[model samples]
Target: MKRLLLIGVLGLALGGCATPKYNYQAVSQNISKPAIGSVNEAYVGDKMLTQGVFMEREAYYVPEAKKKFLLNIPKGYYLKTGEDQKGSYYQPVNAIPDGAAFVGVQSVLITRDNSFCFVDVYFNKVCNFKNIGEKRKISVANDNSFQQTLIYSGKVGSKINVGYREFSSNLARPAFNNDVEYDLNESKTIGYKGALLEVIDANNQSITYKVLRNFNKVD
Candidate 1:
């Protein structure tokens, strides 16, 4: 009897350990596309590497090294390095002499071959790229940050309050949060950020609505 009990417990433990597959369909049905080009290639350290753009800056990836580097500095800007009790720190400089180390900002070393390496002050390493864990691989879905979520806060009188949160791929801009109130008597259809929603029914506790359109699918 004890053996049977132990086997049952072990089975339950294994079942609990099993990870369920993520349902992308439950989250969204809209097609996700890559923000960067498919065959973007750039040269870094004499090695041709795949390139990507993030936060309006050029990014390079080293597949074998499993690393990502961002060109955080802009053209015509020089790199400035300083040292203190904290060791080394770097920043971008707007003005410098013609040959006075006019390398991009955030870059620690610009090699004789014109290759660049960024500074990792935490690790005390110079020209080091961002380390993406060995298990993590880059993908379009992961890169797409556009997310829109709507929540119904409650209702006051005849007005219904709805809140919206959005994270768009426009890295240069900030995330958007909005709260809107609509009167049930005015219209059942609601429009937000090019997407439309229809109120089926609602109360102070909860709201029932259907997505007439998804902003992601909007052109």
Candidate 2:
């Protein structure tokens, strides 16, 4: 009888250790507000540069050979990494940029049926679309000058527009424009890569984006 009792205690202890240290369901229920898009800024030395919107949700931050996996958790969801570990859970609160050596932003879009997270790091810039339905526009600026405008549409057979100009040099000139067609049944991310603007659709289990134009000429 004592042997059985010892075995039961050991089993109970192991089972308790197997459970995650953090409560994922409690964290998910604590998120009372909706997730919103944000821009993470990057700097070279002391000079500030505009690093685009968050694009890649999952990535490894390798700073001086040390690697750490950074995962974006949605507002209403929690992430559990391993078992028998303490504080290995992540819950979304605000924009937490990846890496200690880098300055950037992490943005995520959460709907009733889907969750999309992305990161904008270093010199790479990306634009985010969240709560897209019918027609909506997102504009970012410094001081009073207009910087970039992200237009979104959920209408079938409609087109999304992105209009902006350089704030430093071309402040008075007309903003350049790019347009991408929208599909109601698809979820996508549209942004700039190097010099080209593209739209990525992740609908059919495959992700793809089309280059629209070279926006680098204006830069």
Candidate 3:
């Protein structure tokens, strides 16, 4: 048949061509590198500073005055005098606000280069945290959010944005107007009275306290 003749002719032509050879291998270009032990130094030379609002759940002494403002009432609708005091961006909370507990690692500055350095932050005069000096690890999300262990490194004059944490207020339906800062002139820290965050402005004179908010990261 004609089909048989076509197949015979195609086979003869195919036999005349050559087959190419190929190799399967992977090539890496990385050269030399130091061992992990080489990074072992007494310290990474960094400082840790934590900023957050201190919400005292009970009787605690705060240096900042708890201000009370009363609105003018003509009479009768049950006059609501200011029961709670408003604080600065360094806001305040009477007690740990219900659902707003968050922490952020912001900036890390090199404060000491010794074998061990004590880094602590205070809110008002109650909230305080102490972290060991080291390289902290963390996990990050696409939305620029992350959680991690805190680490510190840098020369004496370097500043690194590390982390931040917040304790939001839980006292309303919509749950708005919540802040994570302490009152100005507020001096206090965990079980002791001290300053949490000290901001010497560009003028080198103005001082203010700060609160750590959520949606922050160091990871």
Candidate 4:
């Protein structure tokens, strides 16, 4: 019995260690509330630069290295690394480590509206707008986490204008500007990727929908 208990305890410890740590900062106070078109443009820009600036998932940061490392762990926070290629933060320290692996976003200067937009390596959006982006982090405990609802704009005759969006991965473009028109008389169901929805009712200002199936990735 004692041996079995010890094995269970060890298994729990191993499982805890396997869980990934999230050291993200609180939402940014200055959120970038870009227009819908601007948001679409940002996604396209990210897709274009996917192979260039946001290419490397991880890089080594040496103090003597010619390229300057972009520190993105919020303003007051600090990122610390160990000699064993592991990163952790404790009390504040000044001395820079010799070789540190940078697993966060890459520093890419993207131009947006004559201003430089620092694209985050994670979501490919402006790094400073981390807080605004967190809205997309749906809670797994919520039933709506599996849903991909449509956004209603306006209706004209039999055409209904709606928008669809979903959280994007680092390797792909963010989903945006999926505004499409559906004919109410012809069909009440609409789909994107594998997410199916039934438009029960709609008007110029609002829409009522029934989620037929949860969202799935596009093949």
**TM-score for predicted model 2 compared with the true structure:** 0.19
Candidate 1, run of 10 with poorest lDDT: 12-21
lDDT of 1 by residue, 57-120 (tens): 2122222322233223332323223333322222333222232232322333333333333433
lDDT string for model 3 (1-219, tens) is 553353354331211111111221212121111121122121232212322222221111122222112211011111011111221111122111121211221111211221111111311111111222222211111222212111122222222222222222322222322223322234222111121333222112222223222122222
Query: In model 2, what lDDT does residue 95 have?
Result: 23
State the weakest 10-residue window (summed lDDT) of model 2.
26-35
For TM-score, candidate 1 versus 3, the one ahead is 1
Error of 2 at 136 (Å): 28
* Rank ordering of all candidates by TM-score, starting from the highest: 1, 4, 2, 3
Instruction: State the weakest 10-residue window (summed lDDT) of model 3.
Output: 71-80
Which digits, one per residue and each the tens of the lDDT, describe model 2 over residues 46-150?
111132221122211111221123322222222222212221322223222332222233222222222122222221212122232211112222233323333
lDDT for model 3: 0.21
Per-prediction TM-score, please? 0.34, 0.19, 0.14, 0.30
Arranged by lDDT with the best first, the candidates are 1, 4, 2, 3
Candidate 2, lDDT over the whole model:
0.27
Q: Pick the candidate with the highest TM-score.
A: 1
Poorly placed runs, candidate 1 (over 4 Å): 1-144, 168-175
* TM-score, predicted candidate 4 vs. hidden true structure: 0.30
Error of 3 at 93 (Å): 44
lDDT of each: 0.39, 0.27, 0.21, 0.33
